[model samples]
Target: MSRGTTAVIDFDNLRHNFNVLKQLAPSKLVLVVKADAYGHGLKQVVQALDNVDCFAVATIEEALTVRKYRPKTKILLLEGFLDKYELKIAFEQHFDSVIHQQEQIQMFEDFQTNQVMNVWLKYDSGMNRLGFSGDEYSRAIKTLENNNKVNELILMSHFASANQKHNKFNTQQVEKFIKFKTSHEISISNSSALLNHINIADEWCRVGLALFGVSPIEDKTAHDYKLKPVMTLKTNVIALKQIKAGETIGYGQAYTAKTNMQIAIIGIGYGDGYPWSLGNNATVKLNNQQARIVGRVSMDMMAIDISDIEIVDNITIGDSVLIWGINANGNLPLETVASNAKTIPYVLLCQITSRVHYQYVE
Candidate 1:
């Protein structure tokens, strides 16, 4: 049999998470399908959730991809059109664009089109990354409102620290965003904001990680919110070896055995999108037993200490290993793996390389 390095995408789990988020959300849901639906497969996800209120992406191409599958559903460009040509395409595709800068406004004014476009006016608020300053933001609202080319106008802002439930900055940002609110619809809550119960009444919520059955909140797992993991990454043990107490394992000889130990080399590593930085304290589920990682992770494989496993002798080559997700034993939350890798779940999911095969299940 071939190496069993695979990412299983459970559409049922995805739908369940969507329904859970819908119940928690105050109003409309703008499902963020950017980064290929957080590397779960964009086209598949867009088609699976055909009845969602809207699908938001980071690029115009991603929006077009969603439109290709769900022709009638609303698609939004989070970054908006970059130039006159993109602006034209947005109007042609009937995509909602976010106007965050004065330059985008100027492009709208210079363009000649009979078609009207829905616009999301982004305010700087506390996050200095995008959107116009307070003064500039006010002018843009007026400009878009008066422009006959603009159809629906929605006010929006981003949260800098919504993950941190008690951060005072969230309150400050919310207060600033409220000042610009008029009669237009608004979207501000992200996955963290909604999960943290920091949402406003009837505002659109743009959820990404949580939509894919992963938690965006710190110190919490998806199960805590009754969300099931959609992606379960799995691999297999390729080789097993026994080494003496003084022997070291893998590259850099980073891990030295204090006692006689058994090691299993698994057919997955950074090349398969498993984080290279993960080792030592990091663990994987093998045959319902926790196997601690040893030495530095290589490009193709890594070794796990399985000496403590009660069934060490029973585990042979090609035994299935759970990198992260639910199995017969129990669930190994991606959140836990992320913490061990010194990164976030988003990075772990998005960084999955092409070498790893993906299997979608209904």
Candidate 2:
């Protein structure tokens, strides 16, 4: 009877999501398992999705973690090499790298390795974050093409606004990327583009959030794409109390009750990856009814207003409360919680801390 919360992981649902993405577009998928598989536990997720075309991670360390679980599977270092030493290790381990900067190209030029490495040439397109610019793109590509240490070249770009359907920037970026075609493999679509913009062509799709059963499109949901939620964050109501009108709740007296009401204190907080900003706006599920959190979210507990619900009597102390998950009888989706928190689902999912228990299901 630990008051600590638990994160239930459904491996079957994760596999189902992989298949769903593969069916959505007949292309190879590089499941982006960065941020410890979006905080779903990296080793467990990699063990589950080892059959994917490849895996994408943000660091050489993340790539190494995936390599431990998936020894022979192709692992891409999305951030590419950090130094000359890592470049040699990446090749020794057969890890693919993304070349996005001229400095990286210089690093590649400086290194002399007999092991030919696969490289994904990143084009800035319009994100202006990573990847090479106009003439630099040609120089980098030409340099890699001529370098004997480079084995294969793949063209890639990240969409700045693919989630917004009919975004002109999507077309502009795609058009820009198409100009760099060098008969190499191409990958551009993320979860949003794969679900919303299916017309875009690519040999590979780098999917991260969608594989975790979260939708990237603004107008649609995971249900719209036949994806299943893989992670369910659950906790229990430890106590309940009645409050009179004009009384305040939590620190700073943030919430003043307008009327006499009942509140339930759940054992979860920002320390457990629950956003403190979600105090007044977040919703949780109890007996299939939504309960709004009131006042500020403390480090160990938060108060929820259960006065408006019909089954308050039935929701006793020690009863289960769903922080976020998919349920047929009104489970609170992560998207809803994220929307209320004024953030994207990715941030919320990745923010899940290690303090929470992880229960993996086959």
Candidate 3:
């Protein structure tokens, strides 16, 4: 049998999360489908959802990918175009663009297209990332407002600490964003901002991770917000053996057995996008019981300590193992895994490699 490392995508849960997010937000939704819908398969996700106000992506090619599935749905280029060639494609594809830099605005002033383009003017409130700041922000607004090619203009900014509900930076970002807000519609609430009830946007809220049924906030799980996980990563036991006390396990002999214990080799590892940083610290679900990882995660496999499991003796080759997400016994939140790995849910999802198989369920 083939190695059973797989990412099972539940479209029903995806739609459910979308509805939950839509009900929570005051304005329409700009579903962020960048990074292959957070590695849950972008094309399938775009086609599955209906009534999406807009689909936002990081790059021009990703925007085009969404466009291929959603012919008429609005697609926003989060980083906007890099050069005139991409700008031309944006216009041709009717993709909305985020104008955050002086050069992007200059491109608009120089391009000779009769086709009008919608633009999101991103202000660098505090993130100090891609955005216009201070006088540059006002100058860009004036330039875009005068440019004939520019159509609907929306004011936007990003929250640097929306995930931390008590972070004062969130308040500062809102205040900075509000100072420049005009009669135009605005988009400032990312998944964290919307979920945490921070400053909800007036016209649109760009949500990405939350829609995939994973929480963006620390100290919280998606279940805490009534969100169901859409991606359940699973693998299979390929071998089982008993290790004597003091015997080290796997590469570099990272882990030593304190007593005679059972171990199982699962067909998944960093090569399949499971974080290597999780080595010797993370756990996987086997027979509905948590099995501690025993060593450094290898390229195609890892060892799990199954000696303490109640059903340890029952586990056999080809038995299913849950890396994360819902299963028969219970759900393992990606948030929990993220915390253990010293990372975040977004990285875990997006880092999933193509080596793992994908199974979509309605």
Q: Scored by CA lDDT, what does every candidate get? A: 0.91, 0.88, 0.92
At residue 40, what lDDT does model 3 achieve?
A: 97
User: What are the root-mean-square deviations of the candidates from the true structure over C-alphas?
Assistant: 1.0, 1.5, 1.0
lDDT at 162, model 2? 87
- Model 2 residue 104 CA deviation in Å: 1.3
lDDT of 3 by residue, 1-362 (tens): 66899999999999999999999998899999999999999999999999999999999989989988899999999999999999999999999999889888888889997899999999999999989998989988888888888889999999898999889999888888888878889989989988899955568999999999999998899999999999999999999999999999999999999999999999999999899988899999987889999999999999999999995778889999999999884578999999999999999999999888999999
Worst 10 residues of 1 by lDDT: 195-204
Model 2 pairs in collision: none
Q: How close is every model to the real structure, measured as TM-score?
A: 0.98, 0.96, 0.98
Point out where model 2 deviates above 4 Å: 327-329
lDDT of 2 by residue, 1-362 (tens): 56748888999999999999998865799899999999899999999875678999999889889899899999999989979889988989999999898888889889877788999999999999999878888888888899988899999999999898788999999998889886898999999898885567799999999999989876556888899889889888899999999999999999999999999999899989899999887789877888899999998889999998886888778877889985433567788888888889999888887788899988
Answer with 2 or 3, whichever has the higher lDDT: 3
Error of 2 at 279 (Å): 1.6
Off by over 4 Å in 1: none
